[model samples]
Target: MSDILVLYYSQGGAVRDMAQLIARGIDSVPDMRARLRTVPKVSANCEATEPEIPATGAPYVELKDLEECVGLALGSPTRFGNMAAPMKYFLDGTTSLWLKGALIGKPAAVFTSTGSQHGGNESTLLTMMLPLLHHGMLIVGLPYSEPALASTTSGGTPYGASHIGGASDDRPITEDERKLCIALGKRLAITAAKLVA
Candidate 1:
């Protein structure tokens, strides 16, 4: 079975839940498996550091994961309409991969959770794609054909999957958002499988 990397940096747990949903979708496809991973939180104090292993949740992503995965689904909570610093920090360290064109031709998709309906869901997803694009990966996105995209009052977009987590990070992923996230993952997995075939 081919592996698809489902990498994410989530603070409030909403993005993490979305990642799991996406992984489920990827795993649903024949001969495809989801490899869940997460980035460590970035600290403002230069001397501060996270433990080598997280106390819980997915492992810290390694460069090898990027090198080995057939496809990628990236997720993060929005920080002022952009990806959070931790996720960006992790991507910044991928210069070695970029130099070698390691991610070239692979399928990639982005997802994000924001504080409100207009709180940078689409913008965050768009910005997250830039680095993947720079790495020469093909961007995979949701299509309007997904009924949830048209019906979602919460968070669903053609750009990618998204969630409106509310100001207090309390809102749940709506049914439409859940469906779209799964659809994006399934679509990305299928595309990657076809490319490698």
Candidate 2:
């Protein structure tokens, strides 16, 4: 079976929920499986370090995860129109994989969550694609054919799946948002399967 890595960093749980939805979508394809992983939180003090394993949620991602996966679905909460620091920090450590072209030609997609309606969800998804582009991965997106892209009042986007988490960051993912997330994952998995075959 081929694995699609669903890697994400979420502060308010919205992105995490989206990641799970995406995983479900990936698993919809025959012979495809989802591998969920997350990054450790970043600390202000450079000397501070997180435990070897997280206390809860998914385990911290390892570089081996990238090397082994057939496809990738990256997600993060928006941080001023960019990916969160933890996710960025994790990507920064991927130079070894970059040098080896470990991710080249693999299918990839992005997702995000934001505080407001215009809280940089699209920008964050776009920005998240930049690194994948540099890695020579094929970027996948939710096409307009997905009805959720046109109908979502909360968080689906052509760039990728997203969520509007309100000011307090407590809003749950809407049905449309969830559908888009699954669509994005299924799309990536299907693309990966085709490419692998």
Candidate 3:
């Protein structure tokens, strides 16, 4: 089975929940499985270190995860219309992967959770694609055919899956948002499998 990495950095649990939904969709496809992973926070004190294993959530991502995965579904919480700093910090460290073009032609998609409806969901997804593009990955996005894109009042978008987590990050993922996340994941997994075939 090929593993499609569901990689994310979620602050309020909303994005993490979205990742789980996406993983479910990926697993629904034959010959595909989801590998969930996360990144540790970047310390303000340069000398500070994170525990070898995170106390909660998925294990921290390692560089090898990139080479081992057939596809990627990346997620993060939106910060100022862009991905959180932790996710960006992690991506900045992947130069070795870029040097070898290890991710070339792999299928990839993005997702994010924002504090408000007008918050940077689309921009976050868009910005998140830059590094993937640099790696020569094929960008996967939700097409207009997905009914939720047209109907979702709270987060689904053509750019990728998204959720409005409210000002205090207390909002739950709406049914429409959940469905779109799954659809994106399924689409990504199926596409990856086809590419491999």
Candidate 4:
């Protein structure tokens, strides 16, 4: 079966929840499945370390995950209009894959969780796409055909999918936001399946 890597970094569980929803969408498609993964937290001190395996949630992602997947669903909690440090740190380590052109021609999509309505969700999505672009991956986005893009007051964007995670990071993903995340995943899966064929 073909698998799409649902890779994410979530602090307050918002992005993780979004990842799970996206995985569901991907798995709903024929001949596709989701491989959920997360990155370890980066340390302020270079000497600090995380365990090889996380205590809970998705296990830490390996570079092989990127090379093996048919598609990628990258998600992160927003940090000053960019992906969080852990996710960025993980992406920065992908030079080996980049040199090998391992991700080239694969389908990819981005998602994010932000603390407020205007909390840089779109910008974060755009920023997240840059590295994928450099890797020569085909970027997939939620088209206007997805009704949630028109109606969502909380979080949904053409750049990708987003969730208004709330100031305290306690809010649940809204219905429209959930639908858009699912749509984005399904779109990526369908496109990847077609491209592989």
**In candidate 3, what are the lDDT values of residues 82-171, reduced to their tens digit?**
998888998988999999999999999999999998999999999999999999999999999999999999999888999999998898
Can you list the residue pairs that collide in candidate 1? none
Question: Each model's C-alpha lDDT?
Answer: 0.94, 0.93, 0.94, 0.94
Once fitted onto the true fold, the runs of candidate 1 whose alpha carbons sit more than 4 angstroms away are: 45-48
What does candidate 4 score on TM? 0.98
User: Candidate 2 residues 61-81, lDDT tens each?
Assistant: 999999999999999999999
Consecutive 10-residue window with the lowest summed lDDT within model 3: 41-50
lDDT preference between candidates 2 and 3, better one:
3
Candidate 1 on 39-69: residue-level lDDT in tens? 8887874221689899999999999999999
lDDT of 4 by residue, 37-118 (tens): 9988878753216888988889889999999999999999999999998888889889999999999999999999999999
Q: On a 0 to 100 scale, what is the lDDT of residue 107 in model 4?
A: 97
lDDT of model 2 at position 10: 81
Task: Kindly report which residue pairs in candidate 4 clash with one another.
Answer: none
User: How many clashes in each candidate?
Assistant: 0, 0, 0, 0
* lDDT (Cα, 0-100) at 104 in candidate 4: 97
Q: What lDDT, from 0 to 1, does candidate 3 have?
A: 0.94
Tell me how many residue pairs clash in candidate 4.
0
